[model samples]
Target chain A: MKKLILLSLIILSVFCSCSIKTPEEYYKEKEKGKYTATISINCETAVKYKNSKRKKSEILNNYKVSYNKGDTVFTALKNACKANKIQFEYTGAGDSVYIEGIDYLYEFDCGKHSGWEYSVNGVFPSVGCNAYKLKNGDVIKWLYTCDLGKDIGAVK
Target chain B: MFKNFNPIALFIYFVYVLFISVFSFNPIILTAGILGAVFYCLFTLEKKSVFKLFGFCAFMFLIITLTNPLFSHNGRTVLFFINDNRVTFEALVYGAVLGLAVIEVLIWFKCFSTIFDSERIIFLFGKISPKTALVLSMTLRFIPNFVSNFKSINTTQRLIGSDSRIKRYLNSFSAVITQSLENSVITSDSMKSRGYGLKGRTFYSRFRFSTRDIVFIIISTVLFALSIIGRTDFVFYPSIDAPSLSGFSIIGCFSFSALSLIPFIYELKEGIRWKYSISKI
Candidate 1:
């Protein structure tokens, strides 16, 4: 019981830090359930004009994955990409993960504003995708926002 | 008599120096902070403690600097590739700067902790809030008291010559905890009889603001302002360039040096004054 309290305190401290966004911070309160999320890479419009040689099917256009406890949206995306044999490139090992590319279409490939962004249930989470904890029935859409996330309707 | 200076002035001066040391990452500025701290420690700290501080700081510096380039692959001029990640020249230099900053902050804090005693802390906090002052003073005293109590208990148990060293240590520790609790009860009862935490309580302050204190405070405050102006335009990634002494940065550099050296300067001044006065006599 004492060890459990200590562990929870450590978890709380990790979550409280504002260095980068974590998904658990996106929710109003902690919720427990099995979750399903969908991920897609949308570098098609950007890649089509820029590089015609790269195949559109090379990108993970659509994939669905279920999340367990302590699972994040980034993990879901990672699992989906791995299972489907789609190339997914990300940097950072922990909660501060940055998704840099999907398939052959990497960041700065299309334009200066092009990068990966994620939305859960139509609302973009304020925290990083890696930090966002998944809840039951969470719907995730991973898109390539070409105009600093403005094209994808992300607020931050 | 506290090196013939007011506690408030001394506290404020240390605060300014610590603030600058914590924030500034320029190598030259960090070097100055380290030098000032070393000078002060050489004069003030025991010989053993001074050596220990230097050794510990150097060890930490090397560890922090060496590991940084391995993990962070930032900078343009790659020195060599270790496991495909380029160990850039800029990253190594950046790591050194960070390591130096850490060392500077630690040594400066050591000086601050040694100089400012519980009396000074209580006097500083006692002015505005008496309850907080009492708590602060008690917390400060508790550590030393606990240490001394533990030592005495350990010695007493060892003298009895009963059990093994580990068992004796465990017994002493348990005794120390119980004794400390008992001591607190006795202490509170005595304080109650003496009317601690009562209305209209008067405090005896030994610290007096002299002309030197006023001048010192003013100068330190000015130095702090100047140091901020001399901010280094420093970035550690993609490429590395030494922060050139821009006109504004020069002011900051000078101010930071002066602020950091205040304690050393005071001691030097006092030494000179003593020698000159004796010569006159």
Candidate 2:
């Protein structure tokens, strides 16, 4: 009883938000492997395409990028967007990066079910973009589906 | 427990803890305040009361966590979506932390209410403004008295075979209203009969300050000051870039921890002493 308060106090203070090194520092402290991935925005089948005259080659394509082993899909896609000049809009969630739009094509812009969806190795990741860390030879696709990812063959 | 101390010490201690709970948004400092409150609750309150508080806090925590992600879709990570809006883990975690901080502060107030009863509150405020103190004390007394009266009336009705809960509640409510009206009339009559506010009116106080009280006041005030001075600036949203602890923050954390745990420590020491003395028999 005498030391109960004292012990708990010490534990609480230390466990408190005193410090969690930045992701950069964390990776620097540990050995990291080199990895490469491919990311591209697919919007050829968006509902807007039926009425617009924009060509498929101008809107959809592939991007090859390299990232550190622990780099998330969000980071890789972000870097690829920077390199390729693709417009991207996102919001931050604690661990998940919330993707709202790509190339000015936002969710619900094409239709009620149209939005951005990401798939790794042709499978839609159940987790958020930032939550899915990149791996060697990973294939990431940004699919824009006007029919709830049905147009991009990504929803199922 | 708080009443045993000089009202000065009690007031200073509670104010400091409450301030820290409100201003210190960091998860760790907030957690310490919460742990301090939890310890206070565990030591002073019944198990049922503590559990009830915990259940309420947990429910609040869930609501905050689930709802924050819906409105503020800020974060690099998107967990899921409702319609076109993305729900992020960052917002969820942020809400949970904020919710925990609020719950901890509320529990601290609960502990405050348990320790600083009306008499102590009146004593604390009485010297500054007599009328204010009287009103404050009476307000505190009226609520509990009204509740207890209602309960008793309901029990009597139940004993007389009124089984409908709704009817009993309504009956009790009306009975208390009538009782309050009668009480106000009698109270005014008694006050008028005694010439309460007449010239040469002077009030008597039972409180006596001791050397221990002086020492306690000085210590608590100084420690609370240190805790305030040591508090660091923090921001939570957009990203978590919490600065590492410096000397001042460390001092604040230690002092805050020490200040909040005072009651618990005092009670524990007294319990040990009493047990030891009893064992001699």
Candidate 3:
């Protein structure tokens, strides 16, 4: 009986030592905020492939994005596309973003006329195209050819 | 009687062992846990098999340590250099630590498997249709049989000149799947023919909860609670910035490890009693 009591005490002590704080409590301690936005993608270079000679029409519609504090730029872009109801495909090697079957070839290109710039922690890169870490309020833009001109929507 | 060899206690201890091994940073705690597992296996398992397992774990540990530095490059302290590449002291230590953790986890899992043998499966989940239970039991039983069967199938395939790497892989995979499906069908037929779940099925277990079980359960539960509480607010990292010895911390870590050994001690006591009774007879 005495042995049993001692063993019970040990078990209780170990259990109490390892208890984890709830996720809500952790976030409250960290003080994070959430953001939502829309990301648009247009494919301009797609040619007629199947039983048609006319140029393929490109569209970038229905992008929805949401992210919390400390989310990376890639994650933010993904969340934004999901929130805006836009269909997008990721090129697996982390180069180029595609929307509605239209590939945005210039987003990853660093040459002049690429019309894309990347910044990390408010500092622009000197050379080479690399992933830029994102901060709050940082904006990412992609310019693609569209026949219908630009469309804009707000995210809450 | 095997005093205090309760399945519930063994399950709780197994969980606690895994928890401590993953969380505890102190090398002493980790080493003690590894040694305790080895000792427990020695006390319970056949000697030759346990020795073979120990040798395999040692070989695996060496291979992991040698290969881990190729991928993970973290840690500040560089111990040596191979050409332009640096072999950090941290990588070797980390690999050994991970290897030990894996072996310890496997040992704890083995204990759980032994404690909750087929009989306990029937007792706890007997209400689950006999068809389902029988399928699960057969699946568990078929793993070893499948491995041996695959080896024989591969040898025959090699003899038949169908031994290209791709062909071997495809043939072996298809063979195992076909055999497993056949085994499952046979098991189901046998179970149904025996009227497995006609009306209700009865189960027999060699386990019962005595006073010892109650005491063991209470103690293990309490220890689990305490370990969780101790870990929650405590910041061990960043403080572990260096590998300096602190005697008090060492003692504290070992004490926790020793706490995990309660079930093993209980089993040892049971073994001793059984031996004594047999001798007297």
Candidate 4:
């Protein structure tokens, strides 16, 4: 009984440690079935900087993805990037994961105020991407803004 | 050579080198600073101490360079995945640059400590704030004194046949702490008796602003200005930005290298002059 209790505790801790599941694992488990979403990554505002390393404005246009009920915009974006083989990088984890860069363009690359920002259904959520949960048929757009969302028309 | 220069000149030289080492991330600038510092250390410090310093710096550099990729996962050109996190070439480069910057700054500081001894420190700050200068000098002097004091205490304990290792160390540490506290009180009392912070106090110093010092100061200031004006911007995240060798950046690197080597150059000139004078005699 003591051995069984220790094993259960270890299993519980393992689950707790990895509470933030990858999209593939979430799809495999399908705890609340699945819902479809679309995500696009663009560096439209980077055009203002002539010397920027932006390959193209449209990185991934209207890319479709699937996620579970509790999945966030970040999860959908991650799934889309993985499927399309597009490079993605972020810092922190869970609800605090900041999308640092996509396609080699990082924060402060173009200018001081330049960085990656995300919007859901045409509304820019002030919170981090991982913190903003996604609904079914949601449209997620990851934009590289050179002016802190002002030039991207994301400010409201 | 260092002693002949005015305290202000030596102070300015050290400050400029430290500022450049700490602020600039350009590869050329960093490499130049490291080479200059290592060369200066070779000239000034004993071989054994230099080797020890280099060995410790290398260990620290490797630890920082390796551990950075494990934590920072933001970069292109993924090498592999450790626990599903991408370790990239850019992060590795960034970490190595960071490690070099830290080591370079530390070496420059070591050089500073060798030249800017307690007497020079007192001379520099004594006029403006005598109390602060006294405290700073005393604090700086206390560290090595504490080490020697502990060693003597430990030896005395050993002579009296205290054989347990843990007990010996613990006893010596406690004794050192108490002794330091007592010494601080005595030192303060002595200073008070001497009227140390009294106004209208006159200080005697051998340093003077000579023609050679004026020339040295001008050269260092010009080099420092050139380095600041021509410093290159570098990016090492998401993707490693290749260090551009633009004309301005090359100028910056050259001037910075020259600035860092001033001390070594001075020492060499002095050594050559001494040899020539001996031969002539």
Task: Supply candidate 3's per-residue lDDT for B172.
Answer: 86
Ranking by TM-score: 4, 1, 2, 3
Task: Give the TM-scores of the predictions, in the order they appear.
Answer: 0.65, 0.61, 0.54, 0.82
What would the DockQ be for model 3? 0.02
User: lDDT per residue, candidate 4, B1-281, as tens digits?
Assistant: 75569989888888898898889887678989999889889987899989998998999899889989877877866776554456788889888998999899888878877777778888999899988988888888898899999999999999999989899999999999999999999988998898877898878887778998899889999999999988986887767776678888788989999999888887888889999999999
Tens digit of per-residue lDDT, candidate 4, span A5-41: 9999998887566445343443344222379888888
Which parts of model 2 have CA positions greater than 4 angstroms off?
A1-156, B162-168, B188-200
Model 2 chain A poorest ten-residue lDDT run: A23-32
Model 3 C-alpha lDDT per residue in residues B1-281, reported as the tens digit of each score: 22235666655666776887777655566677777777777777799978888888788778787776544433335444332133455666777767776776666666556566655555545666665666555666677778888888888888888947788978888988898898778877887787777775566667787787777667766766655544322222112244444564544554566666765676687888889999999
Q: After superposition, how far is residue A12 of candidate 3 from its true place, in Å?
A: 54
Interface RMSD of 1: 14.1
Each candidate: RMSD: 11.9, 16.0, 19.8, 6.2
lDDT (tens digit, per residue) of candidate 3 on A1-156: 999999999988875765444323322332123764444443332232233232533344434445576555556555543333232233333423322121323232322222323233334443322244445555444333222212211111
Sort candidate 2 into its docking category: incorrect
Q: Candidate 2 or 4, higher lDDT?
A: 4
- Give the better candidate number (3 or 4) by DockQ: 4
Positional deviation of B45 in candidate 4, in angstroms?
1.7
Q: What is the lDDT of residue B35 in candidate 2?
A: 80
What tens digits encode model 2's per-residue C-alpha lDDT throughout A9-125? Answer: 997887573454433332233222377787777777663566644355334466677788678888887677655545456777657677877765667767688778889998997
